[model samples]
Target: MSGSLRHGSGPRSLSEIARSGGPTGSGSFVYDEATLRSLISKWVALADHYDGSMRRINLGAVEPPGLDFASEALSKSANTSGTAYLKYLEQNYRYCVEQAQLLQDTLDDYLGVEHQNVTELNKTDQPTGSQSGI
Candidate 1:
C-alpha cells in the first residue's frame, strides 16, 4: 500500500493530491489540535486571498481591443479561457474554505470527546464514601 498517489506510472500532481485530501495511504488521518488549527487558518487565508483575486478580476470592465472578425474571435476565445480560469480559481477557493471548516469541526468534536473522557475519569478518581481510606 503505497502512500503516494500515482497517475499511470507517474506520481500524481499537486492539484490531484489536494483534491484527494493529501497523501494518506490508509485513509487514516491523525493530527494534533495545534496542527488542525493551523491548517484551518492557512486554508482560510488562502480562501481570502482567492476571494480578493476574484474581486480584482473584472472582465466586464475591459472590452475587446479590436473590431475585426478575427480580433473578435480571438477576444471571445480569450474571454472564454479567462472565465474558465477564474472559475477554477473560485473552485480552489471554495475547496480551501471547506477544508478549513471540516478541520475546525473535527477539532471541536475531538475536544468535546476528550473533555467528556476526562470528566468521566475524574469522577472515577474521586473516592466514594464507602471507599474512603480511613
Candidate 2:
C-alpha cells in the first residue's frame, strides 16, 4: 500500500494520503472519506456532551429560602454562583447550537437535500392506496 500513494507524488483527493511524518524518512498520510466522516461524527458527539453537561449543572435544584434572615444569608452566594453557572451554560448552549447547525448543513450538503421539500401532498385526482387498481 505504501508504494501505491505517497506525498508530493501527484494530485490526490481530499480523502487521500498526502504525507507521513515517520522516522523511516518515508512519511504517511490519510485523506480518506472514512476519516473525514469519523472526525465530523466525533465533533458532533463532543458538542452534544458539552451541552448535556451544561444543562445538568444549570438545572440542579436547591431548596427555596425561608425567613428574611436565612434568605439574606444565602441569597448573596446563590446569586453569585447562579449567575456564573448560568452564563457558562448559556455560552455552552450557544456553542452547541452552532455546532449542530453546522453538522446539519454538512449532512444536507452531503445528501443533496438542503433545499428539497419534506412534506406530504394531497391530490384530488389521485386514488387512495386501497382504491388503486393494483
What lDDT tens digits, residue by residue, belong to model 2 across residues 60-118?
34444776777766766676787778777668756744544544444444444652211
Across 1-134, the per-residue lDDT of candidate 1 in tens digits comes to: 58985657522543334344455565634476788666766676677678778988965233567888887777788778888879988999888766766665566665654312322322355445332110
Task: Tell me model 2's lDDT, rounded to 2 decimals.
Answer: 0.46
TM-scores vs. true structure, each candidate:
0.59, 0.40
Instruction: Show where candidate 1 strays beyond 4 Å.
Output: 1-29, 60-62, 113-134
Tell me which residue pairs clash in candidate 2.
15-31, 15-32, 16-31, 19-28, 20-27, 20-28
lDDT accuracy of residue 124 in candidate 2? 26
TM-score of 2: 0.40
- Pull out the clashing pairs in model 1: none
- For each candidate in the order shown, give its overall lDDT on alpha carbons: 0.60, 0.46
